[model samples]
Target: MIKRITDSSAASPGALCRLLWESMLELLYPSNIYCICCDNLIDDSRPYSLCDDCLTNLHWANERTCRCCGKILKEGYRWDICTDCSSASHSFEKGFACTEYGGAEKNMLLRFKFKEKAYYGEKLAEIMFDRIQPEELDVDLILPVPMHKRKEKRRGYNQAAILAYHLSRYMKIPFRKNILLRSRETMPMKGLGAVERRANIENAFTVSRGWDTIIKNKKILLVDDIYTTGSTADACADVLLAAGALRVYVLVFAAGANRTV
Candidate 1:
């Protein structure tokens, strides 16, 4: 009898080729060996694959932040909440972020979201995880601000989901992607005023069937790539609260500049 290689026992030609290609790529161009922001060489010990300079230059949101929205407030600004938060009531209980949305942070996040650099999600999530206080981890579950099916399909992946997935791993919280969904397509939020952005995202999200029971009385942690105007986050929080979630707190990678009047 002759022994034959089964599909399970033998490497397929395509798999072998891919393995070789990946091996070659790793040998020639290693991953995480360079800073994600400036492409400077970084060591394994560097947190978030960022160099010392990039890390120092990054706009961390650890300074005075808006009490309601978590965006960094300018110095000498006496308001607890940002101008945007003061003008409108957000559905979320509160929010926190890892960095301010500007300069290097903005450029990096834009590349992460629109340029298909999904690996950035991991480092961003790690930073966001560091932003969460011990008491904030009391949430019962974690969820991403969902993207519409069409948009997600077109974009290849939902950035928020990617961030939330990594964040769940870091925080050891249960993460659900499909429980909260974007049920409607909306226009681009860019260039939209606060009211316009709110209206654009209104009713855009809904809880899936059978999730209401699980959501009921649960303290939820909502994750997103960025928080601007609180429109999308508020919309998602509204639906989650309506589905019986006791509380929805937001964790975003970046918070837009405080629109102080």
Candidate 2:
């Protein structure tokens, strides 16, 4: 989670450094000057800093999404839930995603996560903010899927927290970064099967000790950059629910295509 700043003039040293870095990024990659997806020039009128071609090509998950996981289902499939959700249970009450994890989304999200393009989070979150409005979700608080301290320090930022921060600002919901934490780092989920992923992520999250009162009986929106097997979200949701959260809903920028079989 990004550190909270009570005041700009008296920011903590870490906050001050992030502020300076953001300022530099603003000058170098100002919004409305370049498209976030295809890098073509775009005007402010284009939403989310996307060019017309990229916007047209972007795979919006506007149809046939799995009811449980919110991943785009295969065309003409006669199922309400995806294959993964049908085969296993998830802790999250529901899930929402803005786009399908297609080629364009994969490229853009890779840049946002691995490249020094933190500003891309703003555009992605703006799109997610739009997605949330239609759902009419009434979450009491927003939190990000946490990263282990060592890994976060190595990466310089947590992509999920960046998305959650922008979402909190757009939705006016209170955002808490330190509540749910990644207690340990596990092997990267890439190339792992669903069972392996779940085992890898199990018991990897824990809630802060003193946040029970605030979490009790409250609805939570769990923010993340992507949703794959739902292992990561399920682990975090299990911890949050154990800490007394009423319901945990997941919101992501992109989701993997639903399995047909």
Candidate 3:
């Protein structure tokens, strides 16, 4: 009896091509790939890791912004200042935010924080770097605003740390993770007035003992994902300044369009 043999190549060209393509993909990209915005399969050629539709929907802060804080400012507004900054005094010598907290930008931030899409940090950092003026940013260290130990353990990562790591790489600054510690975990600052938020975060942070020597008379760039009332950043800056940091500047990915106090 003669047995019929199947030639794998002759069986199906499409199947063979698919297998080769899949192998190439495995070698080229991450296994669990998905769109950053819509959780759909990402196209191999898209510039962003987001699907086309979601990428189109992304609203960049493509307008003029406050030089001090990166908040979107209307056309004809005075240069270097926004209404909010004009009225308020910020502890951070200066700040930079990439986008306003609305539309796709807001969604991306939410995903980054609560959904573990930590890779977004790189993209956000890129945007931030573009907005920052290199001549104005001479810093000795990149310090991330710390999350409390309990919260850090629960999340398994701090978003600010991720942002700081990327910013450090982009800016060539030393990234220090343990220099600042969140000594307390206060209630969420959302919905609270600016004064309340400041009060809540006051005394919530402390610089680690050895950090005093390292940061003494050194310029620092504090990295955070958001700047709401500036409470968290202020608290961190206060500790760093008190510990002898020469100057403290903040870099955030987003900030409220309208700020009070």
Candidate 4:
């Protein structure tokens, strides 16, 4: 008949400690943090928010590469420029990339573009941030490949713009998305031959009116998601140079296997 003392009840010190511990966790981080690539639970200390395996699988463009286009050179190759770069007339002074455009890298880019995975740009930009030395490029401003109004509306966001924004923050350079405009949205360039790619993007871009003076005589870095045949970068570079930009350099997250000199 004596009243029992329930020491393990909600009011007990052990229960209170667990509650406080959970509350502190809630205060420290989001309820559901996961890796951006594989959706695995990210370790508390992993700043990249991507699993280590995915990070390891990222194909860094770390071979003897073309100085102009950054494509992997054949073994025993001695030329500073690869065959593709030596043959092509690239408008940009130089182009750089963090990874080759295939395998896991290709899949990630495809998702970032068409699968509403825009946040993937964060990791891509981080990778490129280490590869690009903005001071050496001496870029006055950063510009992203613009999307046409209708296309941007349909896509919800421009992947290139997201990358340029992160790149700007890393390099402490100003970013301008509107300076260079995509005059019109053309058909998708996927599977297009090199010549077709060039034709597809030719004259597809122009500098916005009145803003040309700002970039005139000032170096510019053009940002994009991928560098395929260099046609897109070249096209954008041509427009910037035409607008009097002192020099236009290109930076991309991935470099395609097909390189045109």
Candidate 5:
């Protein structure tokens, strides 16, 4: 089978020009490697973009995590279901999270979203897709949680949508971006309780009209940058379910920590 290039950013005109320049550089110099995070020189033989130091420092979601949401459990906690998942009802069937939301991981995500370190998304997507096999999810389509038009206009990109696009191409699953629409903008859900978060995001999303036929009975993988209380995911999934999606699965870059505070 032929391999399709999965860096969706490269599809855009600006990105295409950059890719051409990089191609020319590679041809002329023959060898140069840069770290995905620090821009430090790296060995050309490395398969991933991250340098060894950065790779060693990056945190992976490798704890004894919850079955439903993938949140890391506190030590000596034997239950598979996390506190949040146990008490709440999530519209999605399951979730796969890639890293803890703390320290270097948290800093990197903040940079990815707030600082517009856009290329970081490609590395995050590569990690997420590697950890959770798309074929295993059996999803017919990949849908990134949508952003409100106003916010997206200022931001110039929806970070989650970037991840979803790359995932769709790498996994060879169809991606329909506009099918799931964010009807309104929401305040940041940070520091809110689960109930408040759910309320804050309620009715924030809707499935686009005339797309019901395409989504009906199809399995969908909902993509996002982070999973906090899952309020955003639930709101999005609820609409998809209402539109007759068979089930929705979630994949995220990181999960909010289950702190003891």
Candidate 6:
């Protein structure tokens, strides 16, 4: 098991040396160090698990995006509000994504979620943090989009909670994991149209009883791995607002280009 390192029990020189040696050995072994993006062998000094070539191709969301939803748009647009935001009424005030959901980002999210690669959560959270302004996004509480009980039991971890923990630490905000509860497991939103996705997730989430005492009137930032149709976030935001939250905002690692509202 990986023990949390406390100040009193710092890593010893021998342990550090052993870790470095193991990392070097893994790099030397031809089959061990596979790229997180393309499953290709990566060189020893690469910062991320992705190979340099894949890193070059990685698409970061650097364009001027929607002020409300952060969807990248074509040039000559006014304030980057996409058609979806222009037409739809979303519950959350605004949201931002760090990257587009494709290529390197898709691979990373899959590994993090399905392969139980927990370390990727930290890297992903860091990337998400880098894209937002802490002061401007001053939130009273940080909440991870909750996983259903059965799903959490099966996976043994909630990726969104893990990401929220790191983000709370980095931003000096209080991370409240229990405020929002997934009341039911909805069908997967993949391949579903926006309206269908919304209906699927609608009423699937609820604020935990008594959580109102902790979250009432608080400005909350909801953290999640991906933003697709905005259904899940919208549902959660609706519940949170109904439960007396002053405002809600979402932070997601990636946004799908094909999805809107």
**Model 5 over residues 91-161: C-alpha lDDT tens digits?**
89998888877676776777777765555666678888986883377889999999887887666567888
Ranking by TM-score: 2, 1, 5, 4, 6, 3
For model 2, where is the 10-residue window of minimal lDDT? 1-10
lDDT of each: 0.80, 0.84, 0.72, 0.75, 0.77, 0.75
lDDT of 5 at 253: 85
Models sorted by lDDT, best on top: 2, 1, 5, 4, 6, 3
TM-score leader: 2
Each model's TM-score, in the order given?
0.88, 0.92, 0.80, 0.82, 0.85, 0.81
Steric collisions counted per model: 0, 0, 0, 3, 0, 0
Q: What does candidate 2 score on TM?
A: 0.92
Q: Tens digit of lDDT per residue, candidate 2, span 177-254?
A: 889989998999989999899999989999988988889999999999999999999999998998899999999999
RMSD to the native, candidate 6? 6.5
Candidate 4 lDDT: 0.75
Local accuracy of candidate 6 as per-residue lDDT tens digits, 1-261? 111221111122333443354345445543226666677876656655567877777677787777777766545665457777777878999988877787778777888788645545655676777877643786999999998878776665678987888788778898877789999988888888889998899889999998897888999999999887688999999999999999999999888773342
The list of candidate 3 runs beyond 4 A from truth reads: 1-33, 51-56, 76-80, 133-136, 259-261
Candidate 4, after superposition: displacement of residue 20 in Å?
30
Best by lDDT: 2
**lDDT for each residue of candidate 4 in 1-261, tens digit (9 for 90 to 100):** 111111122122333443355356545644336665666787656655557877788777777778888766656777878666777789999888877777877777887778755556666777778888642777789999887777876666678987887788789999887899999888889899879999999889999999999999989889999888888989998988988998888899888763433
**Superposition error at 169 for model 4 (Å):** 1.0
Expressed as tens digits, the lDDT of each residue in 80-122 for candidate 1 is 8899888788899999988888788987888777865656777
Considering only N, C-alpha and C atoms within 3 Å, which residue pairs clash in candidate 5? none
Which of candidates 1 and 4 is the stronger one according to lDDT? 1
Better of 1 and 3 by TM-score: 1
